[model samples]
Target: MVDLTALLADLAAESAQLDALVVALPPDAWRRPTPAPGWTIAHQIAHLAWTDHVARLAATDPAAFYGSVIAAPDPARLVDDGAAEFLAPSARLLARWRSGRTALAEALAAVPPGEKLPWYGTRMSATSMATARIMETWAHGEDVAEALGVTRTPTARLRHVAHLGFRTLGHGFAAHGRAAPTAPVRVTLTAPDGSTWAFGPADAADQVAGPALDFCLLVTQRRHRADLALVATGPTADEWLDVAQAFAGPPGAGRKPGAGRRAGARA
Candidate 1:
């Protein structure tokens, strides 16, 4: 079982780091477009803030959140237009985002450990919910960081995201309208500190081996699979990498190879 408190602490730290980077950016930087098509830095921040608000609603008031946020007559257009709706002066948007993140953390922490929280796609335990939040935080932060030309230090916290990716392999497949392979696929990664981080059974035949950073990048849609140094063995595992995704909802059109890399960060 994952340590919920530690995960919350890491989530807070990740949020704080992103906050520092965004808050310090000059006014023009907020308006600059990110790697995500049509999304400016302001859009990224607004997306996070709005998602946090929705996450809080899911945890604390699922029925209400669903009625209002999910029940929108034009859900697709709402999402498509969402990043633009929360725009404010850079300072106000940042402040709103920071406050939303803080409240989200608190709201998630209040949920009972074994109870499930309703999400758009699936119900999640407190640990899973927090881990998903961290994954989104890190993944979205990358877009913001890349836009500002900021290089971030990858941390062991990525193990959480990598684990989520590996664990949710079935969800990724099903979300994309594909059959999920039943065979266990091992993932062996070299952590930042040079220690090995392995997932799945040690003796599993199907396997993926690479840097933890690369694995996280691939699953989060931050780095296209072709650009990642990940090696997937066995037919099922290889095919899995072809469409690996860490987040839920509809299978999104992911980044093209070399399309989203930030300057001065690893290729």
Candidate 2:
């Protein structure tokens, strides 16, 4: 299993960094286009802030959380409210994001080490929740960073993201109306700090290997794996490449070249 404490600390630090990045933006930049379709920088930050709030609620009341709140009313209306609520004012958005993040971190720290909290469809431990949050933040941050023409270094915490990607491969393939690939693929990621992470069978004939940042980019569909220095050794590895996903909900349609280059480059 992954280290829960370290994962939470990394997530909290990343959230703080993102908070700083958002606040550093000029007022006009908040309305600037982001990589996410139809979302501005304001929209992206709003989603993050709202997700943090949702996490807190899930931590507090796992059993009733999804039913009473997440599944209530029109989903689009909820999303719109979440986006509009945080985007009310640039300064207030930044303040609320920072303050809410602090509270969320505190709540995470208060949970018992092995207790499982209710999430989208399964019960997740505090550690898993922290890791999931980090993955989501990093993925969305990629959108913002691309819009700003900035590059972020991949961290050891990305192992969590990669693991999530591994777990969701079947879902991605199923969404495309295709059966899951038959063969296993090995993934090896080298962190910016020089730590190495691996997933899947140790002796798998097929493989994907690269820096953790690139792996995250590919899995999140923010960048094509072919554009990076990733190595795919077998048919299964190649197939996995076409269907990798790191986020929840429906599978993303993935990106095509030249769609939005001025926004940012893939890490």
Candidate 3:
């Protein structure tokens, strides 16, 4: 069984890490653009806060959650709309994000075991929901770090994001309107501490291997695959790398080859 408590702890840590990055930013700094197309640092935090708000509703009030979804002006712009709705002064936005996330964590922890919570066109267990939050916090944290010219040290918390990326292989294919391959693809990654983190069948012929950080960046679409050092052994694995996405909804346009931190922290 998934350890919901441990996952929640990791979620908290990931959020705290990201919070540390932006907690003291000047008001003007909040307007800095991130790698995500039109998102500023403020937009990034607002997105997280808005997601936490709806996610809390999903846990505490299912009907209200669905109602909010139905009331969305445009489904295609849901993510951006939420971000814009939650935009505020730096202090208020920060406090809103912190409180919203805390409420979400509490709501999730109170959920009954085996119960699933409604999500964006899907449902997930409390553990899975927590994991998803960690992935987003870390991915967006990367954008925040890059914006501040800060290179964060990868932590074991990335294991959650990496695991999510590996588990979302089929989702990635389906999001692109392609059939997911039945063949298993073994992923062997070198963790931040130089330890091996392997997933999938041990004897699988198709394989992807690389630094855990790079894999997380690729799956999150924070960096172009061309800029990553991952090696795919089979055609399936190769194609999977090209279309991988850790987030739900549609496939992202993703960053260009040189759009990431290739040039410096400023990149």
Candidate 2, 1-267: lDDT as tens digits: 767667778888777667767777888999988876677888888888888888887888665677656565765356556666667578888788877777888888889878888765467778778877888888888788777888777666677788887777776687667888778778888877888888889999998888877778778888766566788889878887887776655566567654543333221
lDDT of 1 at 183: 88
TM-scores for all candidates? 0.94, 0.86, 0.96
Identify the runs in model 3 with alpha carbons over 4 angstroms from their true place.
262-267
**How would you order the candidates by lDDT, starting with the best?**
3, 1, 2
TM-score for candidate 3, residues paired by index: 0.96
- Quantify all predictions' global Cα lDDT against the true fold: 0.82, 0.75, 0.90
TM-score of model 1 vs. true structure: 0.94
Which 10 successive residues of model 1 have the least lDDT summed? 258-267
lDDT value for model 2: 0.75
List RMSD in Å for every model shown.
2.8, 3.0, 2.5
Candidate 3: C-alpha RMSD after superposition: 2.5
Better of 2 and 3 by TM-score: 3
Off by over 4 Å in 2: 68-71, 76-81, 258-267
Q: Which 10-residue span in candidate 3 carries the lowest summed lDDT?
A: 258-267
Expressed as tens digits, the lDDT of each residue in 104-199 for candidate 3 is 999999999999999986899999999999999898889888878899999999999899999999999998999999999999999999999999
RMSD of 1: 2.8
